[model samples]
Target chain A: MTVPVPFLLGAAALTLSTAMQSPARAQSAPAPQIALSCAGCHGVGGAGEGSVPRIAGYDRQAFVDNWSAFRANARPATIMNRIARGYTDAEVAQLATYFASLR
Target chain B: MTRLTRRAFGLSAASAGLAFAAPATLSAQTQARLVIIGGGFGGASAARYARIAFPNVAVTLIEPKTSFVTCPYGNLLLAGERTLPQITHSYDGLKARGVNVVHDWADGIDATAKTVRLRGRATVAYDKLILSPGIAIRWNAIEGYTEAAAEALPHAWIPGAGEQTTLLRRQLEALPDGGVVGFAIPPNPFRCPPGPYERISLVASYLKRHKPRAKILALDAKDAFSKQGLFQDAWNELYPGLIEWVPLNKDGKVTRVDAQAKIFETELGTRHRVDVGNVIPPQSAAKIAIDAGLTNETGWVPVNPRTFEATRARDIHVIGDANVGQVMPKSGYIANSTSKVAVAAAVAALEGRPAPEPTVYFNTCYSHVGPEYGISVVGVFRPSENGFVETPNSGGVSPRGPLAEQREQRRLEALHADAWYGAITRDAFS
Candidate 1:
């Protein structure tokens, strides 16, 4: 069981690394430079300010996982909930990973 | 400085005309030659997507400036929360994504030749032309204000490489402790619905901190604003003495601006003088759209809502603020979403595939009442047999109750506004 746990953890790490390196499948291209606009209010580290929560510290997989939920009306807010609906599944993930890396 | 002579102007015009006449002959049809006119949200998105969806496509986006400073977050900058550089974007990312980015003004489009002429001696032909040239300031609409006179009293409307945003910012900063700021809000069907209101709130926030006694007098052309009730409550609670809401009928209509005297005249012959003036004048589709025979009497391009292809021009599509799109605000989100549908329709037409039907779209306008508190409206839309219609009773405006948590939620959303701006710009240009 101990041996299996080590192997499983190593595989998970490999998977995470691969996902981060690969270009988002939905985008068909690398993400552009405009992502910097998010850094100010959201924090360069994603440690959000005032009412904005800590998106930077969110789990990478969880961040990617929540985007579809955000887009499909599962999540609701004055802005984010509506904004989340705009991106493709891949954009959600790309953004998710970028912010999660700051964590 | 070089003076504009008749002979020089004529030569420049003739050369530009010839540039439009030149035809671009690519080897393959699948290898599309795409020329996008504007560098705003629509044009930038089209250029980015064209490179991806059709890798073989030769994508060329033409704009006069190398950098694109967005009007979306410019209000925050005016509020002193953000800087000009924070909202600015460069074309380098688009160029890196396999796009031919050209820093030249689009003079005119030769539909017959399928080419666009530049102001200089250059032309680019295209298999499919996407024009998202944004809006133009309607100078003649206001009585005493012209393009030149706007220097003293800045509109700060246009996005990039100009004095508009910076000029307005400096004026706001320079204003006396108890001075008044007059915002001449434009009529409906403008670029950003919540924009003028947001501007008012932002300036009010600045006054609340620095001047405290300064006031924001909003002279709107419309009876109601984007998020009127929510904004009014926020203003009263946050900065009671700092902001004043005046509707069009309540002696708020601005007839003209005397820049020298800093006086704004109303319809009823009332003159209100202000120290800092930020007048968002009436607007129309950019001059490029009108010149291409795409505009109707409204000075905006009428397009098939299903495909965003121009009704008046063949093989040309117009999106963004320049195109007349009902059921969607001319917000960046809608423009970005509409561009996707337009791209898919164009690709399907080119590939002989059935264009997707019932294209659903959405728009969310987030306006910050202060730093942390924000309010917004979310509208979902789908193409109906008649036209694009909002999903009936599907989404509602921001909550009315003055709960502390709700205001905090508004603040979180405002922060998300910056996040989303980053994401959308990345999606479009990066």
Candidate 2:
């Protein structure tokens, strides 16, 4: 989905920065609106409070590799494999950056 | 911003013309007003999303209740696995997020004026209206199944103040050990496609321990249902010979009900006397939608797939179960999932920007069949020229297997279901 967020920021750096330490650093970077639904399972800022693992500070490269493996059915997962196949490469990268910087 | 209609401002129409006359000037200086009706999954999600993603938009949620009891885990309550308090949520979280939460019934909607009339003799105006007013039970849709009849044979479908669900639970508790529990399931285009099957599973799970000799008769209006294979597999594996599911082809459709008599009459004129009856009647878009002339013959509001804005009316985005979101089961997950898209589109419109382009929605519904057992279905849908169609080969149900080898998966999923509830409620209300 082409989510045109009103809080669009000029954080042209889609790549993760070492300075990112908390969710507040990521506030300037608009978490793609497409990623909003993830909070339904991963909790706010991807800091899950239950059996679902937190994805907030996941490694950037690891997040992308995981999505690729899930989409290709190369990884073992409960529901992520099915969900991952639905997103495009761009969306996967977008979500990876968003969550990586979410903390 | 949408042009306001000249009505329901808590003002006389004669005095209302000025409030809406300078819409362009007024909207430019003030934050866009997003007024939502209903406080369930869809409305709550939208209210939270508007505040999170578009803080510039002023969010106002109009719901009659101060607290909401969800229907998703209600079956667990029937099985004595949960209590109403566990599923009920307060609006304080949304209120904390700067959402204006009003506790009053939305009596009528003035579509032309972009105003909602409240039962408390007030009118709430909006720049863009999000109608998530959920489903309304079609009283007497099945013969003799009136509001009074509901007292004895509880539908327990809509979780309004949790009374119906509680009533059904009480009846189940009061039932005799060997008594029969009959279910009159409704047809398609209803809320939660997999709900009745889940309820049957949970009820059977309850009876297995308490009323060992009890029998459950589930009469389905349709031959097949969501996750039918998985649900049937669980029923056979866990509660064998205790539950009988009657399909429509096998004379399963219930045409009449007598709550006081405790009789469920099928379409073939066969009557079955049961100790407890769960008459899930046919449903339609809530009354406010119909009263506002937003519904079609299907008793659902049709909306633009990209924007989720009501097709018949501009600036009105109708989300949740009230809209004709076919191929998307009227599950709470869908309501929560699609709400962001609707809010995004509504905000885009308020800013004179284009609506979101792609039409993607996600849904995951977890059903707890027995102790430490959970099954789920995932769906990913995209819009086609005709309507929304499921993304083939993308979504699937949990693999069916015996609990011996899949015990960990099942147990983990049960825990995950609890986590899903926690995360979703927190995302919406907190």
Candidate 3:
């Protein structure tokens, strides 16, 4: 049986995420680790269920713009604004790219 | 070779094929096995995350029940807002995702041998184990409150099969129009700190429509609770004169329960007679965890902050209310959120890498106080010295205001609570 590409990587998820990091965040926490937290509310893999909006397969630029808006309080949100403030700019960028990569 | 030696060799060989750029040579039989115990918020989420993120690792979930009833929205069933079918979830979703879902009780664990002995006389091996067996009501923690007594005075705490919740609902239905309902709330550090109070609120919401003259006597063992101010505010406004909450300072701690007489006796020896009785006894980690020697004297497991690996065991990670995550409240939201971290850490250890660092865990516990009225508390935690610490200024409760001023806010939050339930269950089961 042929295993999927990700499954072949196994624990390499951590190292692979680290490999894709920018210089400023070269030693930062992996993107997949941060993205997992969103699964609590956004559904596994950010596939939206019910009223929770879908984050998976989102446009990379749109994800970044939405994060910036929520962080700046320029948009109305019940919980996202508060949750956004807890994450750094670099982490948010990484999450944006990570979710965008999902199917 | 010895069983232990052969198992260690199998695990190391599994890790050898997991390098970043290694060829895909591992077959189904050669994959690492991840065995998860219990199928609640923690185990289900961990199983699902493992399938999505670590597809190379085979997952086996051992749970006694084929479907799960959530404890989060159980209070809504008492209020008649939701039905039992609404909260029950099937393991079919996990099976569809390629997880080996076994409906068997996990009788014991052998951490050294890396195997779990099931009640069905079969032993399954695991390269890494995730134990999320949830909590067990310490029966008789209150005098005269044994497991048998629970048939009459149901705790309705565990999410097992939805029987306790449904039994409590039937009792409420049988109560007279002007009868009294008494709740013996437990002390702090129990599963869902805000749960008992929410039960009281929803039961009151039900009584107000069906039995207006009904009274609620909530005798809490502790003085403070999650969102105490907000819960009290809702009680006074929506359920005025219907809820009577007694704090610990006022002799509110229940020392004994006369289940047959339908009575609750306090520490000060005051007896309270009621038409219906709900007793939430003290709790600890589930029996399997205790039997495996994973729990400490406090009856809870202590784990590394980042890895969630039990301090007493190797190749075993503990999550959910079973672990001593002191800074975080033992809520389903925390269990679901921490599960992914635990899975990642377990896989990292299999490959001999460090546990994910600087991990930020998020929790949002939303509770409904009345019809179209809801409230919640948000907390963000990160690993600190040997435990977790709340992220400063990151999370807070819903803004407190009078009903008339914040009517729309309450209505929207109630809707949001429903949406959250749907999304979270899908995340875990579907």
Model 3, range A1-103, lDDT digits (tens) per residue?
2223344344454444345445653422334687877876677668875666888889989988988898788997776777877787787888888888777
Deviating ranges (above 4 Å) for candidate 1:
A1-103, B1-30, B403-405
Please give the ranking of all candidate structures by DockQ, highest first, separated by commas: 2, 3, 1
Top lDDT hit: 3
Query: What TM-score does each of the candidates earn?
Result: 0.79, 0.91, 0.90
Where's the lowest-lDDT run of ten residues in candidate 1 chain A?
Answer: A1-10
- lDDT sort, best first: 3, 2, 1
Q: Give lDDT tens digits, candidate 1, residues B169-230.
A: 99989999888998888788888988888888888888888988888887877888788898
Candidate 2: residue pairs that collide: B5-B112, B5-B113
| lDDT-best of 1 and 3 | 3
Q: Give the TM-score of candidate 3.
A: 0.90
How far out, in Å, is residue B306 in model 2?
1.0
- Cα deviation in Å at residue B274, candidate 1? 0.7
| Candidate 1 whole-model C-alpha lDDT, 0 to 1 | 0.71
Please tell me what DockQ candidate 2 reaches.
0.27
Chain A, model 3: TM = 0.69
State the lDDT of candidate 2 residue by residue for B1-430, as single tens digits.
2333211111112222345332322222334579999999999999998887765467999999999999989999999989999999999999988899999999998877778889999998787899999999999888999999999999999989999999999999998999999999999989998889999999999999999999999987899898898898899899999999999999999999888899989999999899999999999999999999999999999988778889899879999999999988898888888898899887666544566655578888999999989989888887766568888778889888876878888888888899999998888888
**How does candidate 3 score on lDDT?**
0.84
DockQ for the candidates, in order: 0.06, 0.27, 0.25
